[model samples]
Target: MPVFFRKIISPSLSPNTESDDVWEAVRAFLKPRSWQRGSAIDEIEHWFKDYYDASAAVSFDSGRSALYAILEAFGIGLGDDVLVQAFTCVAVPNSIRWAGATPVYVDIDKRFNIDPKDLEKKITKQSKAIIVQHTFGIPAAMDAILTIARKHNLIVIEDCAHSLGATYHNRTVGSLGDAAFFSFGRDKVLSSVWGGMAIISQKSPPKADQPMAEKVKSPPAGEAGQKLRQIQEKLPYPSRIWIVQQLFHPIAFAVILPLYNLIIGKVILECLKRLGLLSKPVNDQELRGEKPLFMPRRYPNALARLLMRQLVKLKRYTIKRRRTVAYYQEVFQSRNEIIMPKSIPGGVYLRFPILVQNQEEVMMRAKRAGILLGNWYTSVIDPVQVNRENVGYIAGSCPKAEIYARHIINLPTLISEDEARRVVAMV
Candidate 1:
């Protein structure tokens, strides 16, 4: 086997030159407004409704922020309990806490998403909401979750941060819940540097639950507007080459990321630099506020402009991801040692996460083969950790999630057909 991980087939924008034109338009609009306009923000919001057919979208600084906003919007706080998947990223429970609510860790099924059965068991009078996450772009049992939510009249907050273009039974993931949150980070389905969005419910959003005016604002258009235009004017150049290099250069990445973190680790220097506290670390004290400090850094202004231009290409990427996932399912079906993800009719595969046994051993093997596998959530770090529940969200509780978390290895599905086959062989 080669000592290099197979490269992902990029489904990003074409002409890579259009980013220039898009940025030019952005620049022209922001000059008179002194970068105070929200049109760029509106473009992102409209994309949800126009492209994904979402009801309404509110842009935020990050996916985590959107998650917190949704919880606050639902009036989930102080002694209230929100059921969350123990297998999801820390951001899930952290959002629950941000709302001044406690998060009850629930087990997950083989799909790596919250188990509907487990969800039903965890509900109580204090329960005010359920945070449904579509783990690894794989849609959870939305029908079952919706049924349970309806029976209990519980608020549903779909974490579409990982399932952007993904749908469950023809309906978009965000629309399935009472409200939804999406991530538009560098690694997400859609890239907008470091921004995120909150998709409000199709019905009425719970006004009593929304953030207080003290914390809410019209949401500034920010500096992104001005920079977007400047980048557009320079788009005709070959900028994607850098993108390709990063995706393909394993050695450079290993060296570069560590160096970047080292420079950022200096608290004194960062503070002196006037790095805003909000920009420094995630605030974990808020129970519906920020917790578990890990936020993706904002992409360079140039990159954001590039992403804006390339947003349309997401459709093609979605198709390739879906097809690649199908191929893996077919080939891996006969392997009893692994549990493959189920098909979600028309959804795109943001990532292809599979369950297995002896994950450490599997990971070691894959690593030796130059396959860089991702451990979506290594531990359930929230609600319990913060609540001082020393018992923590144990492994055996959600056997399926634990199995996937431990033994499951995520293979790249956003690769060319040939690359997909090679990855399967490595598995």
Candidate 2:
């Protein structure tokens, strides 16, 4: 008999009382000109402020936009340098460049966050800010980071893109920084399809006085359909794995998967897009290259309402993720082949990342067993296949980050403890 593995992660799509209430709220709010000043966006801002204990909150079209806005709000542009972790998503560097500031890469520590020692060493007179990313929701050493930033008078902006609901030393991740940003993209802890929030602390520097652009129309219906399709695509992992296993040869598996993904998957998705069954995914060019002064329109009302519903059950979701992390911890504790990051005081585990030798082979075996593992930050900066030099990254500049990039693979936080253990046993 063949074994079938369950999905590693699945978006929370089940509806409840709160979801029903949200739909009713949206329906009532949809009346002609019902959404005025104190509406969905304001409600979300208030929710974030109360939840994170933040003084001020702002929403944006995307998390990258939130970071850009924060950088611009503090006037960190043109000739300024912002230090970021070398092992973060490419969007971090892109946001810095979008603000007309240079991004200086800093190496990561055992916790996979920016190394405070390395961060201090990289500071120059040109260094205006530090974007401390909590990689995979593992909180960085805030005490050390803050000490260095205070001594150097550098702005501290926490990239809570992966760290929503995460904490550092009993304090929420967003509240500890001068300013912070959260992403609500597809895979985020509190996804609203595609949205972001910025929390401005009381001690944050004076923000720009310019008002943001007016609200635009809601996101296209096709966008929701596209997200649905994306979820559907991940559902057939067993079949995908079986197909790959049948190929036998590594070269054939490598060549065929890409070709199938590029040619067959692309054509089907494009057809769906043309039929209005799905929307075309946003490409890198579309996301990047906005002017330094460019300000995106406000978050949509419908999405804000959707996000508010998710917030109602955020605690439950976080608890489940924590349980999964603990399961992985227990299983991998005695295994010398796998290395887990040191536990932070109050960190939330977004994805249970582990370092192993022969990561490619491990991942291939996991896939062949119908396991869906997370291949996050496979490169120093993500989209690993892209040339590092093109993104201003120099090879060997951050050796530790490069090594981690090569060895890291993440376990799903959305599965049950039993499922997690099964994944470990298979590995």
Best by TM-score: 2
Cα-based lDDT for every prediction: 0.59, 0.67
Model 1, 129-185: lDDT tens per residue? 788888778888988988887676677788887787777778777777667788765
For model 1 the TM-score comes to 0.70
Alpha-carbon deviation at 244 in model 2, angstroms? 34
Clashes of each: 20, 0
lDDT of 2 by residue, 1-427 (tens): 2433132222222111233543544453454243222377779988987887765677775687778777766667888889998998777788888778998999999999999989999989788889999988999999999888777767788999888888787888888867889987656776555578877776544223323331111122233223322322332121222212211122222222233323553365355446554321234453443343323435655556656777876788788888878877887889999999976656667777899998999888876665657777788877665455656777888889999999998877766677667687777
Candidate 2: list runs displaced more than 4 Å. Answer: 1-38, 204-282, 286-295
Q: 106 in model 2: Cα distance from truth in Å?
A: 0.4
Q: What is the lDDT of candidate 1?
A: 0.59
Q: Model 2: clashing residue pairs?
A: none
Error of 2 at 372 (Å): 2.1
Identify the candidate with maximal lDDT.
2
